[model samples]
Target: MVASTHRDRPIGVFDSGVGGLTVLHELLVQLPQEDFVYLADTARFPYGERSQAELQEFSLQIAEELIRRQVKLLVVACNSATAAALPLLQERMMRTTLGVDVIGVVRPGAVHAVAATRTGRVGLLATTATVESGAYAEAIAAADPHVDLVQVPCPDLTEIIEGGFPFDQRVVDTVRRYCAPLREARVDTVVLGCTHYPLVRPMLQRMLGPGVTIISSGAPLARQVEHVLGSRSLQAGRTEGEGTYSFLCTGDPEPFRTMGTRFLQMPLGEVAQVDVAGGALAGGGPALA
Candidate 1:
């Protein structure tokens, strides 16, 4: 069993890659006093195509690493990872770790989507794995079965956003194509099913038109994190100083660092590189302090 005594430590957030930065951005805005550590499993690149077992194993490995770092809370910032591993992670953590909490994006986003839709028609734009897992569909259905859901599996949107081409015409065109069916179905609200999707919110808004509302998982997820931390009394005390941000990547650090700066709208000092060897975190490189 892992023991945790830290109560004022930073929150840990992880994704298959830089997509989770969308959640991280919101967290920073909502909880400026809290520090954050973000892990991007860039070596895996996209968890969207992986098997359930594979994704769960990877999520467990990263969660263990974050636990080792003494985070007071854990946020499965990626929709695919959340859908694949949240239950197992929560169970394991509750059985072993103490004074820490784990939260995921799907349920919070689903609740918000259900609340925001006026026509009871909702659209979900997410990775192929999330759509296949039926995570959002089930969550929203549970919240309100009357909601008519249109799930669109956006294949390469994460890659495009992580590639720093989120605003390019090609990206907009792809978003337009993906959203066409939802528009035809007259969905009044669209859920940004993947964390990375928020990086292209402008494009999504344009494609969705003014009448349609686009909701990302960020704000809701951040609110959940805040609630958990507050309930546990793990919320940080107010500090005038700028909170620190730490980043880790399982692939080449340079590209992730560059793209993170672009997507987060802030300069990421340095990104450390780590490797998963034999399904465990092994090598560790330097990270910005």
Candidate 2:
């Protein structure tokens, strides 16, 4: 075993549930030498329907949990959480002694969509909270002021995908319904604004047709992670073999392990349980119910 250093500390990532694993899959492939610690706040899963206040509280709780584990950087892989809490999370991290860098999914996906679109018309399919947050709109506008973004709030899509994805008729119907407006808009690029959406990428592509480019946060977010690690000189030093990863969840570890292995599409070796009950997180601000 090599001696541990500040650079060897694992990157921290959190999501409401297993959806974030899609982002993790990209990171594992892009930065094979870096270790990661991913936390699933399954106790507060399906952030899509939650209010901004609730999502922010949940995000802060999860951030404190990951920080306790000595993470060198932080990644918020859930769109709803990012929409509600990215700025707050970044501020909290900045106050930490380590000042861990924080990155989120929405902006990266928006930037990629702007770059990929030929018609300057981008489509977004995400949860209700994410759509309402206006994060994607701001990000796309910042990337290119001339770009037009068509947003569809898929209130039930995240839950459908999170339920697991052999993708039944209901899932197909839901996806088709969501894709209709984008197809009508004739967007040249469609952004999978929610991490869970990537798992059903094939269906999305089939529905959107071959002429449209599909963008997901995984690839672009992975690139951003690489850039952050390089700029901070925090890249892991393990050169000969791939690095290790571990899991934490506020809900049952068994289900997270089972669904996570499928979502992650990789060996989910072990999953530990974490409790962020009110009394446990003083720094997270009076705990959330």
Best by lDDT: 2
Error of 2 at 21 (Å): 0.3
Question: For candidate 1, lDDT tens digit of each residue in 18-87?
Answer: 8888889999999888889999999987888788888888887787677677777889999998888788
What TM-score would every model get versus the actual structure? 0.91, 0.95
State the lDDT of candidate 2 residue by residue for 150-186, as single tens digits.
9999999988888975779999999999999999999
lDDT of all predictions: 0.83, 0.89
Off by over 4 Å in 1: 1-5, 277-289
**TM-score of candidate 2 against the unseen true structure:** 0.95
Provide the global lDDT of candidate 1 against the true structure: 0.83
Clashing pairs in 1: none
On a 0 to 100 scale, what is the lDDT of residue 123 in model 2?
96
